[model samples]
Target: MKQKSENQKAFPRFLGILVVASLIGGVLGGLSGVAGYFWEDHTAFGAAFAHLLGAASPWAMAACAAVLLGLGLYQYRKSDTAFHGWDGEDEDVMQRAEERLSWALLLDSLTVIVSFFFFNAGTAKLPQSSDGNTITLLVIFLVVIALATLLQQKTVDLTKKMNPEKRGSVYDMKFQERWWESCDEAERRQIGQASYKAYVTVSRFCPYCWGVLLLGNMVFHYGILPSAVVLVIWAVLSVSYTREAIRLGRRGQKTE
Candidate 1:
């Protein structure tokens, strides 16, 4: 019962954090846009800021990529020993690691996309004499992309190891069947219910905010095209998961 309660609490906590982050991002983005719009007429601050950004962006991106790479390497190296004696506590630890890695993958992917935009914006602001700066920025972009790819693969591998039974691939039928055979009806129902809740929550909430952000960017000419692409991806994933969640929910209900 306590575990179930904690599981229920986790959803609300996740939602709250997401909401707070979204609100903060929205406010900061709005303020930056406003400041940028007025920058030309009011002060030299805009140009200076752009110059600083162009100078700093490469280092910033490289640092972020390095941190992600370090984390991924650490996780990959430690995961085996961490799960050596799999018990309920180990299961919980694995679940937490899975969740953290999933979020890391999502956020890091988005960061890479944002870095592209930042690179473009910075290069546009650069003077023609600074050809070297442009090359440096390009190199940083490539390095960040490489790091992001490595981190993503590492996270996926870790997630698969932690939850091999949950992997969704037609070729994995044998493994899936074996996993299902290992679980009793009650365990299956619990899994189904949990999956249904997670998918439904994301499908219900994520698309609405994404749509708002997409429309806002388009109308304001924010040049966040990657966001639009991400929105579409999110919509597709939400729909796919919603269908699966419904199927799982129905199965759980029938079993009940």
Candidate 2:
């Protein structure tokens, strides 16, 4: 009886979702039709986006860097403080700080890369551009790189301070490898779990990116390179995960 009741209740939610999907599909189809009609000779809309991002890339990066430094340092200090007393929430504080700082590093790196991209793109027309303007962009790009490196090193050093068990210098070429080797079993397990979660997220998000890229191509003719890059990333992730899983399975069976 409960199963039947649950099935009956599920139909309304299912139908609602179906209706919502249909509405979205209908809207997209209608807009795509209009876009296709206008897309014939006018690619201004598409090319304009890159130009705009390129123009604003430095400012975007500056904002990200500011947050990366300010909030990151605050969190690090909060976690590093010794006054957490009885409950021993220090571990939690450190973990939270580490996670936020890691994200800040990632965000800052992305901004630096984006700024570099725009700088490179803008340089293609350097002959047409004033030397002063070109020099400014170049200087900003260099500063962005230097700032990103500083924030990354600070995050790593503060992380090490909070967790003395952590090892490896941020400047070391084999830092990641050394850090992984230094992790104890529990830390290694946590790292593995986080990696697996990231893998799963990227795997799921790839399809949405594919769909967006397809739409962009249809409307703006950005070509297939973006989609191909996403495919390559997905393929690498899947292959590496599978290879590691198989290797671990084999190792488990060998009574070494």
TM-score of each: 0.48, 0.74
Give per-candidate clash totals.
Answer: 0, 0
| Residue range with the least summed lDDT across 10 consecutive positions in model 1 | 164-173
Question: For model 2, where is the 10-residue window of minimal lDDT?
Answer: 77-86
- Model 1: lDDT to the true structure: 0.68
**Superposition error at 110 for model 1 (Å):** 4.6
Top of the candidates by TM-score: 2
Tens digits of per-residue lDDT, candidate 1, 1-256, equal 9999998989899999899978877886777567556654655665677678777877777776667566655655555455545575656777656656756666567767767776876587656657676788898888777777667666655656666544433235475565566666886998779877876776676666765665466334456675777677777877787787699799999999
Q: What is the C-alpha lDDT of each candidate?
A: 0.68, 0.73
| Tens-digit lDDT track of model 2 for 1-256 | 9999999999999999889967876787677767877986676865786567656655665666566556655654554453233155546655665676666666666756666676776565546654555676777778877777777787787677666888899789999998998889998999899999999999989977987786677666669999999999999999999999999999999966
Instruction: State, as a TM-score between 0 and 1, how close model 1 is to the true structure.
Output: 0.48
- Model 1, backbone clash pairs (residues 3+ apart or across chains), number: 0
